[model samples]
Target: MIISTKLTAERLEEIKNHPTSYDENSPKLTKAQIARLRPAHEAYWNVTPVKKTISIKIDADILAALQSGGKGYQTKINSILRKAITTGDY
Candidate 1:
């Protein structure tokens, strides 16, 4: 099971006090470096949510169209659903 944690100000301060070895090598990025960054096609969540496998039925035509778009189609669908929920567009 995946566990998610929120970084509250108090928790962040606690983490700041005890630096990990990995943190030592990673310096803060400059504006130029930050600007140069590009997003990954998918799998960009900092802490990936737990995914549950379930069977979902879709219309043949709709399913074919999504599949034809190629790999990451399911991720695309999830994006669509998330947007719909946020905007109440569905």
Candidate 2:
């Protein structure tokens, strides 16, 4: 759902040469501010990419390769599958 728009070369150059203005009145977030802000911010983060579990068959070598990565091997396995599907390597 992330749509990326590339800036034109001239526009990019203009932005590169532009001066930045900081608001002196704006306060930096303290540790307490961050602790209060994080939970609310993180709630809706990465709501996409939903995951489901299912049984599947695979070669022992492939399973070992996945499990050998230690913790989160299942996530690694998923990434491997995703890369294979995207790159037509499966």
Model 2 Cα shift for residue 87 (angstroms): 2.0
lDDT agreement with native, every candidate? 0.76, 0.75
- Highest TM-score among the candidates is held by which one? 1
Model 2, residue 42: what's the lDDT?
73
Tens digits of lDDT, candidate 1, 52-76: 8889999999889999999999998
Worst 10 residues of 2 by lDDT: 31-40
Q: Residue 55 in model 2: shift from native, Å?
A: 0.3
lDDT of 2 by residue, 1-90 (tens): 853467878768878899866576766665556545544567676467878979998999988988988999888888888877645465
After TM-score superposition, the amount by which residue 3's alpha carbon in candidate 2 deviates from its true location, in angstroms, is 36
In terms of lDDT, the best-performing candidate is 1
**RMSD versus native structure for model 2:** 11.5
Question: Model 1, residue 62: displacement in angstroms?
Answer: 0.6
